[model samples]
Target chain A: MRHHKALFKFAIKAGEIMLRNGAETYRVEDTIERILRTQDLEIVESFVTPTGIFATMDEEDGETVTVVKRVRKRTIHLHKVALINHLSRQFVEGSLTLEEASQTLQEIESRKPYPPAIMIMSIGLAASFFTVVFGGSLRDFCSSLLIGIFLALLQQGFYNSRVSRFLVDLLGGSLIAVFALLFVNTGLGAQLDKIIIGSIMPLVPGVAITNAVRDTIEGDLVSGISRGVEAFFIAVSIAAGVGIVLKIWFAVNGGYIV
Target chain B: MILPMALQIISAFFATIFFSVMFNISRKELLYCGLSGGLGWSIYLISNQLGGSIVVSTFLGALAVSFLSRYLAILRKQPVTIFLISGTIPLVPGAGMYQTMYALITQDIEQAATYGSQTLQMAGVIAIAMIIISSLPKSAPEQRKAH
Candidate 1:
């Protein structure tokens, strides 16, 4: 009985980590089932969504344990997900004990994010390179690099300010458009369109779109539609942000054509 | 012409590395992620050069990236999402989305609808590519089935 209890706890812990780290709904359920089957539990069922996980384990002794975990925050940290995935596989293979598996899960949970300097530098480089791939010239690349760096710093500031996510996205979009327009109007870069597209690449909802499709295909209609809505709004907000800024630019310059 | 193509692949490489860093992928696997992205982008560029439609190019590009991610996942023993997410980043329709929005702002309703539909179709094709690649059973199913 005690072993089953510990195993149940460990299974939920693993699922929690996977879910918080942005594993898809189906993957989370599969991982939990695998971990629970490590023991002789007769019944192990798990259901996971983007925001919650509910699982139950029943043994032949007529004992049942259930756990409900509400996941409030979701981020893209594949390192944590990978580590937990490795740990769960090890446990299921019977090489690791219950206590050890739980301990490892704790360690994975507290893993640190990449250094801020590294993140800022990478974002800047990504934006700049995306510009080049999209047909921007050398001058345009340099200009977008500056814009990317600025946007990265701006995003870092917004991370801790407790601002709403929608507002941040809207402002970020407008900022990209305004900066690109300013640079082009000042003759700093020859292409405003390329600059804006490159700078906004990081803000696009690539993961959300992918996850939505995967979830829907896996028969999780709720998570699929919710993630799809989330991606749609992100696209809309970015567009609205850029459109508002462009409208203002046109009005201010008395409709000076592009 | 060749120089620009090389530069495009290099840029895609760097872009993938940067994105992988943001996701905090472990240090050892960083280079592979970048390679996957570069390979996918090269496929995209080459197919575009061969006169494929945007939908076809994106579909092929994402297919390559997804297959590569699966291979890398087995080799590295990590989750496929690590490589798949960053590798497929280059194929997302950010440019089309922006063009649609810009058209709307300029009061070009017809142009806005055209670009909007194009963007939607690109997204649909990319999703299909991801779905087809991810559904393939890995080789370890025998072991999984034993349990």
Candidate 2:
């Protein structure tokens, strides 16, 4: 009974790491099942969602151990997912034991994300490059780079304030539009469209949209629909923020096509 | 023209690498992620220049990215999502969505509907392209041996 409990706990731990790292539902469930099966456990079943994991292991002597883990926050850290996948494979191959695998998982869970300053710089670079890819002029690229840096700092401020994700995105989009408009009016850039589009790339929900489609195809209907709605609202919020700023600009300019 | 096209591809590469860094992809896998993004963007640009509609270009671009990410995953022993998500960044319809919203804000109903539907169709086609690639069976020895 003690051994069964330990193995089950380990399986759930693996699932927890993957789920919290923004893995799809099917991948998490498969990892849990594979981990438990390698231990020679019979009748192992796992159900995973975007927010939780449920699994049960049944032994021949009528011993059953069920584990449930709720994952509250999900961030993109594919490295952790890949690391856990490698550890699970090693454990299944008989090289590592449960204790070592769990220890490694703990270490990964506690690992800090990249420093804020580096992340902000990366966002600025991405925005600048995206502007160039979208056919912005050199002037527009410089403007986007500067505005992107300011947007990152503003986002960090919102993050520290513990505001909801929706509000942050809304404000971020408005801020981008406002800055881009300011630059264009000051003769720093010629194209408002390109500048705004470039800065908005960092806020777009590319992952959510992809995962929503993939989840729906995988028949995880609940997760699929929820993610779809989340993506939809994010798009709406971005559009709304940009629309509000554009409207304000239009009114101020007396509807002139400047 | 050729120089501009090359610059665009290179910029796409750096943009994807930056996003990969933002997502915490390991440094070892960063180059592959950038390649995936650059290749996808170049394909989209070429197709668009060749008179392909936005929907067609986006679909082709996403299909290439998905297939490349799978192959890279086999070689690098990393999860497919590591490359897949970052690679798809360049092909997403950020500009189209913005144009649609701008049209609506300016009270141009016809333009709004046009851009809005174009964005929806492009999104749908990209999803279809991804589904098609993911459904294909992998016969590569490396992938077969990994399982």
Candidate 3:
């Protein structure tokens, strides 16, 4: 039992190290596998976080069980590590405070909303819904809000940033474009504000700013700025498409465009 | 959405906790960070409902977050970033940006500029709010240090 606790602590420590270094999700898993293999330990299941690790393992497996293991090779440039080493050279010098080191590792951790990120996404959704219902006319509010909420809650393959950032941006922009194209021309034109803002809020990079700052602090200014610019443009394009449609409507029929 | 709103609040509540855990913050210090955010945003929504301008409401909302975060850092203990980030989510200028673009596409250069300005205003509102909220606590001490 005592040995189990000790191994568990070591596993956790190993997790903390990976997380702090900014290992992406799969990278973190590989790191843990490396640690377990080094210790000649048995593994059950492993998972990664923006923070650290969660895993279940038992040494008793050494007594009788054999499990098939699968491996894949992934290449990563430990940007965060080189960053920390460079920054530490400027200020404190020598070793990093465990916190700094851990954060650096977590920086390497690939992008995903830790569960709270999802909640933030959801709450922002709720807030958007509430904003429309309370502020705008009910009919315009509902249709636009429904579109916004659906886009947010859909959680389709659009969530994959690497595969679909541009695609999702295009789709989101086009969807809003189509909605505005169809409705803004009609007698009951909707609240453009409600439709555009509420729908696109889920994808904004408030988190990216926080991460970018961490990166800048750790000395990866180029990468940090690039990510920030990329995120900012995706947001801008989402707005641009919808804006174009609304502009056309205003030209055809002169009225206050909200 | 059913009970997901409440669940979201709960998730946000613990998300900060998870951040704290990873960042090496004390466990006891987490909930205040979440509360500070929720409270600030609630106030922003309430004031906006009462006919305050979005700009004014957002400023006050950010102030509310920063104030409590600063107070909690003194009375309790936690990073201001947690509450500030979470609180600012409600204020991010999403609507304004859309309106600006919508104005642009239809060739209403004037209105596009107008709403574009509004979007800029909104973005400015959040940007300043972010700077203020993040700096409010430090400003106090920095002032005294200069004196």
Q: Which candidate gets the maximum DockQ versus the true structure?
A: 2
lDDT of 1 at B101: 84
TM-score for candidate 3: 0.51
Residue A121's lDDT within candidate 2 is: 91
Fnat, model 1, is 0.83
Model 1 lDDT, residue A128, Cα: 85
Model 3: lDDT to the true structure: 0.49
* CAPRI accuracy category, model 2: medium
C-alpha lDDT of residue B123 in model 2: 80
Model 1, span A94-209: residue lDDT tens: 89888888988998999989988888888888888899989899888988888888888888998877787678888988888888998898888888888889888888887788
Clashing pairs in 2: none
Query: After superposition on all CA atoms, what RMSD does each candidate show versus the true structure?
Result: 2.0, 1.8, 12.8
DockQ, cand. 3:
0.12
True-structure RMSD for candidate 1 = 2.0
Task: Sort by TM-score, best first.
Answer: 2, 1, 3
Candidate 1 docking category? medium
Write down the worst ten-residue block by lDDT for model 3 chain B.
B18-27
Better of 2 and 3 by lDDT: 2
TM-score, cand. 2 vs. native: 0.95
Q: Is candidate 1 or candidate 3 better by DockQ?
A: 1
